[model samples]
Target: MAVDDSSTDPDGGSESESSASGPSRSPSDSVSAVARSVADPILEIRDTTVAFNMDRGESRVLDDVTLDIERKEIIGIVGESGSGKSMFASALLDAVVEPGVLTGDITYHPTPDESIDLLNLSKRELRDLRWEEISMVFQGAMSSWNPTMTIRGHFEETLDAHDADYVAGMERAHELLSDLYLDPERVLSSYPHELSGGMKQRALIALSMVLEPRVLVMDEPTAALDLLMQRSILKLLKEVQSKYEITMVFITHDLPLVAELADRLAVMYAFQFAEVGPTETILRDAAHPYTRSLLNATPNLDADVDEMKPIPGSSPDPVNAPVGCSYHPRCPLATEQCVEQDPPFFDAGPNHQTACFHWEEAAEEIPFSLPEQTDREASR
Candidate 1:
């Protein structure tokens, strides 16, 4: 059967992994390449839900999350801890462990029109697409390397898998490591345990780029690094983005960093997206209460802030999440409607969407303020 991978309906039906045959270039692939029109979405996800089956029961990790990532643009997925950030990335990469069920649409655009439903591909086809078409640099990913293997051996394995020349791959690795300001010789010769945390992390980034995939998904790539190292890593990422022209999906809990680097921001809460829009729009006038809370919680250097306001209340457990809005319990402006019914993502502004019933009101309100922290505690 002929599968047109280059085309997809925005309102497409769910595709099961078993339904697809071996992957082949779609008919529209050439046509889209010739067009080369304005910026087009490279990846589009709609109603993606991921669930994990445990000894107790089934726990929904991600709930009906939808997002669109454009070509060569950086999309930041920001959220608190245990808010399904990593799980969301895992879903896109089909890296979710067994006993985990993924549902809904996840489309990957290799070219302008060439769209491959990631969830629809067979295991073999999906394996071929990963790293070759898309790559991921995971958090605490340094441990992923074989402790017994030399860094050079790791690169050899990666290049050999994709059927690329080991010599050329080593040369490419040297260039990337040098660009990232690392001593390529020492890095390649050293094992994972020998290098510093930051070095290991940067090595992972270089390794992921061996194939020069169009899309690079970084799951909190700098979380383990200190502030200075984090800045350095972020700078390197920006350079990589410009030089390779790769679209990136950076997942992190650091709202400030996201605002600084991301072209667009998607705020995730509980198991769903609370808001998604341009960085400026979200920073200047956030529409969702949760988005506002996140902004408020983040300390602003420009303003004379006395204290670091923390968002009150802990996030609900995914296994038994609240009925309507998962954030209703924590949302300051949550109403009866919020508790009873899930709010649809409403258009707040140009390219801005928020899943809050009182979005308009929240948009108009000033950023919230919290009780000040004491000097004794601040000293720490």
Candidate 2:
């Protein structure tokens, strides 16, 4: 499917103005670019849950989560730490650790007639699917790389594992790094320890895209970079997504940071999605109390420093989660109903859903403030 390349950068720059040249089609493009007569959504996640058995008991890290990721769109998953954001990404790739049991359907649509349930796939099948079809840029790029190996060796190893042409893969890696505004030759020759933090992060992204996967899941890709470097990385990610027409699931705890890049936002609280909607709609009119609290807690540059309110209480223990809504303990608009029953997703607006019983009263209960003008402008 063809995607529009007219997306503007979050920094008020035009995507077409980048100096980097566009990449040519990979050698395996013919095999990966199968016809899609299926629906618009590329991934269908239904009633998915991940639980780990420990000495205490079974702790549910991910609740019954259901989400549809559209093709060629950037969807941001935001939440506080331990909200199961990273676990969700891990589950997508079937990378859950031992003693953790994953349930429910995670269907991947690669072609018109093919529908593969990720949970049901064999180990070998899952291995074949990863990297070639869905690639991940894990958190902490420095630790992810080998200190002994040069950047070129990393690319060669990845290509070798996939049985791809080593020479062609290296050439593509050079182009990818160049597109990221990096010195390709120097980066390729240098070791991970030799490059700066920002450089390593960008190089990691370049490596993830080397195989040209259909979906790219990034977990805190800019966690270690400075503000300026973060901005640059976000811009480069946008450019890469637009150029390759690949769908991205960007996971982060910083709502403001994701606000600058995501097309749609999914706010997670207590191992479940509190709200999911278009970026502009969620920013302007959040329905769930947890979502509202998150917005209130976020420090807006345009807003007063005193106005930044933190969410009361911490996330619940996964092993001893509340009976009803896990967020009810922290939610301001939470009532007896909220404490007694788990609320299903209610329609907040067109294509906007929130899992809050007091969806109507959440806004009135707590003041909802918009983000900075620049963020809103960028999202629009």
Candidate 3:
């Protein structure tokens, strides 16, 4: 549902501005968002766009995507199934598939004066960056493994591809697996079919961390796992990050999960971000109606059943989304202006922003005090 920063026609701009989006092309341009003092900017996406050509017309899946990843930051992208959350992270890692065109500036400031434009890189160059510089733990970890290869061999093969020797790599892999609470010998020698779902999940994470890259992009790493497995995996992931100092981009539809892991969050809808800011402020003090609906729909353990808020209607059609405000049709506070002119992303605070025109007026209702909840009261 989305494309990365490398292949698309960016917004409100000429090709000259976006030439840097490609790996081989560097634009003679500057951006206000760029900060040279930030030595650890693992990646950045500016005005990224992606489109899918269909019989009807070109469907814009991503519109002006931007990324500013610093060291050790856990950024969570939350949205519905088709919200293009996956596309943003996938594109950042240069793991985008074909037929999906990406356009925009993706600057990876790997070294000062030496930025890697993922969009312009050759396929081989992109592939090289995948395992060695940037790694991913995809949604279905078990399926990603090979049934034909032994777990030990599979892990070794992954490391071997990066020119890492088997003996030393295996030792490191063993250590990582142990850290994830998996028994080294049995897990290494077992086939993919032999290992349980959770074990395979941990093993997938182990492989991603085996290289210990600077940025680790995970797409719903706990999607189908049980609560116990989810907690176990999250705990292990935190531990590994502490040891490796890996930056993370967690792509999922779960908000509570964001609260637990993310330092900042960005909410996307119909291929664009509705809001982006600090997790606590955005969650408790959201300004956009879309974000408010999402927060309200969160099952409150303490709220009475009738007091809960339910989001109205489904997302707009991605193929031909609304012209002005993408969420206008379903937004409770939508007006004539919202239906006529698309609201630009506006900063609400130091590191907070919302794309809603009524941000100021909507803030109070969005973060109402519900007095006290029975869940917390009883627990105390």
Number of the top candidate by lDDT? 2
Instruction: Identify the runs in model 1 with alpha carbons over 4 angstroms from their true place.
Output: 1-39, 301-306, 363-380
lDDT preference between candidates 1 and 2, better one = 2
Root-mean-square deviation of Cα positions for candidate 1 versus the true structure, in angstroms: 10.8
The candidate with the higher TM-score, 1 or 2, is 2
Candidate 1 TM-score, C-alpha based? 0.84
Colliding pairs, model 3: 7-102, 7-103, 8-102, 8-103, 22-120, 23-117, 23-120, 45-67, 48-65
lDDT of candidate 2 over 1-380, digit per residue (tens): 00000010111101111123421112111111111111367887777788877667777788777777778989999988888888889888988776677787788988636788888888888887889899998877567798889998999999998889888888889889999999999999999989999999999999998987899999899998899999888988989899999999999999989888998888887778877777887888887788888888888878898998998898777787787777888877777887888776655655566666677777789886774475537545
lDDT of 1 by residue, 1-380 (tens): 00001101111111111214421122212112212221477887676778876655667778766666778989888888888888888888887776678888888989986879898899888887888899999877978899999998989899988888778888999999988889999999998999999999998999999887899999888888898888778878878788889999999989877665787888888877777667777777787888887878787655457655678888777677788777889877888988898776555655666677777677556366422532212323
Error of 1 at 314 (Å): 1.3
The whole-model lDDT of each prediction reads 0.74, 0.76, 0.70
TM of each candidate vs. truth: 0.84, 0.88, 0.85
Residue 291 of model 2 has an lDDT of 81
- Model 3: per-residue Cα lDDT over 76-166, one tens digit each: 8888777777777767876656677777778776554568887888978887788877889877766878789998888877887878777
At residue 316, candidate 2 shows an lDDT of 79
Rank by TM-score, highest first. 2, 3, 1
